[model samples]
Target: MKKRQRKVRLIRAAIQLVFFIVAPALFSTAFAGVKSIFQAIAAGQPVTWNSFLDVTGALLLITVLFGRHFCGYACAFGSLGDAMYELTLFIRQKVFHKKGRHGYPEKVVRCLQKVKYILLAFILLSIFTGWYANLQGMSPWDVFSMLTARKLPNASYKIGIILLVLILIGMCTQERFFCQFLCPMGAVFALMPILPSALFKRDRSKCPAKCGLCKKRCPAHLDIDGDTPLSGECICCHACEATCPRKNIQIGQEVEELKEEAAVSKTPVKREKSAAVSK
Candidate 1:
């Protein structure tokens, strides 16, 4: 199980690294496309297709089918947050000889998560009201994108640089701080209608009493046990599946099929034993 967990983490990390280097601007591009659509509407202009729209549309289609795998394994900003959090843990354990907490308190984190939705609404409002043009150099994602592309941000991007630094600081203190509580793009992903086939399902009957490993391991702090269908906040990271001691968690269809197969397998064995006893 430990080996399996390590393998999973390694595979995700490799994919993240590749995407971070190869297509770091994907989120920014897709978001720009969304803004453009509304900006055109506000201007009473016809919305036309473009490369940005193509990117956004493709990502939305993928999200509807596969949950937020892009956030978990492909988003450069999310990968950066994961790196910062891991670096913080390394510093605490190796340098200060102190263990890091898993995350912030669940209640506080849940409340903070709501802020992203508000941020998303404000952004859309700014775009529609034509105020977004005035705020051109204020986006931290723009700064991050510039840095990743090996280009220096101009003097106009000073505020953006500052905001990026602050977000990185937040990432060091909490895992996925920007992703869970601040990213407008993350808010959009969380609201997407993901298919059940892509969701991780837990068998409560198989879970030991009082066991909360899955919830504890979740970066989003989702209430997997209490939430019947699980929250859309799930990024499809599979941390819960990897951490379960009893291996009781599986994809929705997988859990059902496994149980059916187990029942069928036991029936044949039971029938053979009864025949031997009667003979």
Candidate 2:
């Protein structure tokens, strides 16, 4: 509940809202622009310097430094997924009195998570094979774009609807299911080289026994007690820091301050020689 934390939450909310409401209308660019770039490269086109200034490039640079924060805070489909899942949760609780959200088995979920890599490879291969246009209809983000434009689909409409429905169901039952297991763009971000300038981190030394609140809050299901909080799957949402009851979790400069304190305390203070001993 610190002022800065509250500000961060507000900013996150505002970004999510903008993506949800204005992005489709204003930017008109689907969040899958990154995947399109890879497809273009697979087609043997020369990469241009201006390409580095596009949305995908900006997002790539951001992910390189800060992790997949864009997915958590600025993705339109991600915001929709969060809203749909929350609405489903409310309905399940109030209508069905459900206490638990169900999803694919953990083993199955892990296996499915690898499918994004396969999809990425398939897209690249299809581009090289000149079948990219035929398979592009299968993209959920393209479907998202079609839906955004309020245009009726020509052919692959049924497939698009089915995929969208499945995505909705997955979102309802599991947190960030698309980002975790299906987003090709997210796969790229997850593979990017990690920088040391990450924000979210935990002080496990200060954690109380039996406290796993951070784990419950983590949308990515990362083991927050590990040596570093900057996991490949991490979205840099800072939910762990916000949920920690012990207040041991730190982000940004707070982490540096804690390290400084630890270092200062560890430096031993030499005791002055007693006057009697000197005599």
Worst window of 10 by summed lDDT in candidate 2: 25-34
Give the range where candidate 1 is weakest over 10 consecutive residues by summed lDDT: 223-232
**Over 4 Å off in model 1, which ranges?**
225-230, 261-279
RMSD of 1: 3.0
With candidate 1 superimposed using the best TM-score fit, by how many Å does residue 273's alpha carbon deviate from the native?
Answer: 12
Q: Count the backbone clashes (under 3 Å) in each candidate.
A: 0, 0
Best by lDDT: 1
Q: Candidate 2's residue-wise lDDT over 1-279, tens digit each?
A: 456457766787788898777665222242345545665687677655443347667777887777677878877777777777778878988999988554566566667778877877777677777787786466666677678778766686667667877998889878778877887767777788766556556666667898777775677656663325337777777767776766667654455566676556655532233544576
| Residue 23 lDDT in candidate 1 | 98
RMSD of each: 3.0, 5.8
Best candidate according to TM-score: 1
Compared to the true structure, candidate 1 yields what TM-score? 0.90
Q: Cα lDDT for residue 190, model 2? A: 75
lDDT of 2 at 155: 81
